[model samples]
Target: MVSRKEVAERAGVSVATVSYVLNGKPGVSEQTRQKVHAVMSELGYKPSYAARALKIKKTNHFAVLVHYLGDPFEAGILSHIEHQARRHGYFVSFQTYHPEDEERFLQEVSGRIDGVILLGQSLMPETLNGLRSAGIPVLSIMEPMQQSEWITTVDMDWEAGMTQLIRHLAEQGHRRIGFMATGIPRHPHEQRRQAFRSAMLAEGLPCEEEDVLSGGGRLEEAKSAMKHYLASEAARTCTAWIAANDLMAVGMLSACREAGLKVPGDLSIAGSENILMSEQTEPRITVLDYPRKHIAHIAVDMLVAIIENKQPRGCKMESRLLIRGSSMHE
Candidate 1:
């Protein structure tokens, strides 16, 4: 392994100048920095992570917490986050969130990572407080169930998105609309469900209790729920359906097809988080685009700012309706 002294000799700069350039400090001139970097690259002199961490008191590692790895929406956001983190000279670690394992997870990650980013997990207030007390910067990519000053959050205007979707369905002459939700407690599903109700009521439409079904955030569960809905006499009145996510929307589509119902003819369908699979269905789904890449960049940027002791405010991005064949009733 070539040392910094050798890089300095090859570049004809002092050892301090080489150190300044490698650590991205301000003491070195741009020309000198470039020369030092070129020499270091030619010599393949990689800086030791342990040495840098010891000098700067930072690990350059971040952890992201998610409910599970199966959801494509979360997976897409995670991929973007990994890319952005690498650009910022940080590495990402992923962990599945379970309320039962919260304490143990926190204990293990304490002092190991510079910050934590939460991707739509419902964590206890005490857990958040513990992290805050330990001086760990946390940024949540979803609106937290419990608001805390210690944590920054980035999310979308879900109510506005739902209102737009419901109004579009109403304009297409669909008065009786049903909603499919994830049954997970204290999750963002509640926000979308409330938005659906509010939008329906705003349009003077009837949103009966029976019209709302829980699918437990799984494709099979959503299929089962849709089957049950189809068996009920009330199903005859529902002319459209909106799901909390694209996965459930796809499941509902399968159920509708199996029941001999043609999409947009018998029942129009829409969903949130326009994942890749949504476009591959027989009749592509209309959904609310959640801006996954923007959310990921904002979350990572905010967490990085917080790690540097900068006061960064939480942000909310906008969602737009992506009209497609599934919701275009003639």
Candidate 2:
């Protein structure tokens, strides 16, 4: 590796001037700074990460604690987050978070990462305290967590999205609507379930315990659960159903295909977080489009701001409902 001394020598500058330019110190003139950078690039000189970290107290790397890497929704959000992070001259890595080793995970990532972005997970008090003590800023890409005043959060309105979906079904003359959810303790999905119940009540529609299906959050699990639902007597009770996500909605569509149930004719289904596959499905899924790019932009902006001691631009957004062939206007 080429040394900073060689870069300084090639650029006709002292080592101190090269150090000033590398550190962005104010004393270096723009012309000299550009010349130093050119020489460093020409010599393929890269600063030592360890030395830089000691000098600046920053790693320029962030980690995202996410659930379900297999899910396209999370994948989409992560891709956008990476894009945004790169635009900000930062690097992003992700870990599939498990609750079992919470403290150990925190301890492992504490000093190595500059910030942590929790995607669709509730803020645990102890975890927050640990990160706080470690001096690593945190941002959650979900609804505001309770007892989490210090952390930043960004999300689309869950209740509003649910309300719009339920209202649309109601306007389409569907009274008995069911909800299919994943059997996970995801805080945002819990919020969505509450929103579904509340919206059903507000619409004066029947919200029965039998109408909700709770199982795993994978496509195959949803499909298997839905296949059994189609075989059960409870399937006759609802004319339309809303899934926790588009993947589940597609699973329902798959089940319907085997059971010979025509979408919008026998049963209507709507989904959340219009993942890329949601649109490409047969008959297509009607869904509430969560703005992944926008959410990523906000989450990255807030987390980077907090890491850099800037004011966080925290905000909540609205999801737009996309009516597709899978939904019916009866």
Candidate 3:
């Protein structure tokens, strides 16, 4: 309801000064900036995002594209991304797409915003080509996209995460370990699966192909896959299993119970994305603590730099292991 003009008048400063102070721009004296803040609080004047965006011809709004919002772990990361984007004078929008509905996604995103962030979705060659043609600067998180010389990207090092998990499992005397992953075409999980295979093979262990199960990356699908996996005799042979994400691991844990197996007592389970639910369970899940907040911050920081036409040193995020009762050996 209150306007910047009223705040400026009350602060005894020009409108331009108020603008600079409100936007956290440089060139305003700290003393005057404090005075402007006091006046703003007193006047209860809030800046209009629409006005700033219109004047600057920048949306200050970015869209995050994912497959779905079913996973609470991913939802938490999205919440962090939204908070970080807002702190930098930007807002975030989200869209969920089916991996098969490629045409719908392209139709929906064209010219809708200033930039886009792709998370955990398949990087089709055509989609990347289309984005390039449209001139929309895109940054991918969690997905390992093509390392094009021109496009900028920030991704979690899944190989590093899995290597840590594999080594930990090996140390616990888990020679014949199983693995579960989503069947989606994204690169991050695929890289983790490959890393698991490579790590196990290098350790003089023949990782059984039948031990790997596909969840299709959906929670219900993961549950079904895990159920089938547990029904098999091979499930009891492996002392441990590595899941691509905590969601599938949770499903696996449920399946283990339904099959009358004890966690870590009969079978050990490890997962990625150390979400909140992981720690609360009876036998807490051991997981890879991928830095979602850091990923969001780094992506936005890169987007801002690219938007301002500033040459930024692009970045890559790293992941680490967090041990818990789910995978610990007694």
* Top of the candidates by TM-score: 1
Error of 3 at 31 (Å): 60
Candidate 2, residues 1-330, lDDT tens digits: the string is 688789888999999998777654568777887787667656755455446445546878999988667778878889999999999999999886666767888768856888888887655555654554455667878652444555667877877899999998888889999999886764456667777898899878999989999746667888999999889877778989898878888888889988999998899999988988888988888999878888998889887877666655567789999999999642
Q: For residue 312, what is the lDDT in candidate 1? A: 74
| lDDT against the true structure, each candidate | 0.81, 0.79, 0.73
Candidate 2 weakest ten by summed lDDT: 46-55
Q: What alpha-carbon RMSD in Å does predicted model 3 have with respect to the real structure?
A: 14.6
Highest lDDT: which candidate?
1
Superposition TM-score, candidate 3 onto the true structure: 0.74
For model 3, residues 1-330, the per-residue Cα lDDT tens digits are 678788889999999888787655679887897787667656745455345444455667777887467776667678878888899888788876555656666666655566777776555544544444344566766654554433567777766777788889888888888888776665357867887888777777768878788977655677788788777775577889888778888888878877888888788998888888777776889998977787778878887766665545556667788899898743
As for candidate 3, its clashing pairs are none
Model 1: runs farther than 4 Å from truth?
1-56
- Give the C-alpha miss distance for residue 167 in model 3, angstroms: 1.0
The clash tally of candidate 3 reads 0
Compute each candidate's TM-score over C-alphas.
Answer: 0.80, 0.78, 0.74
What overall lDDT, based on C-alpha atoms, would model 1 receive against the true structure?
0.81
TM-score ranking from best to worst? 1, 2, 3
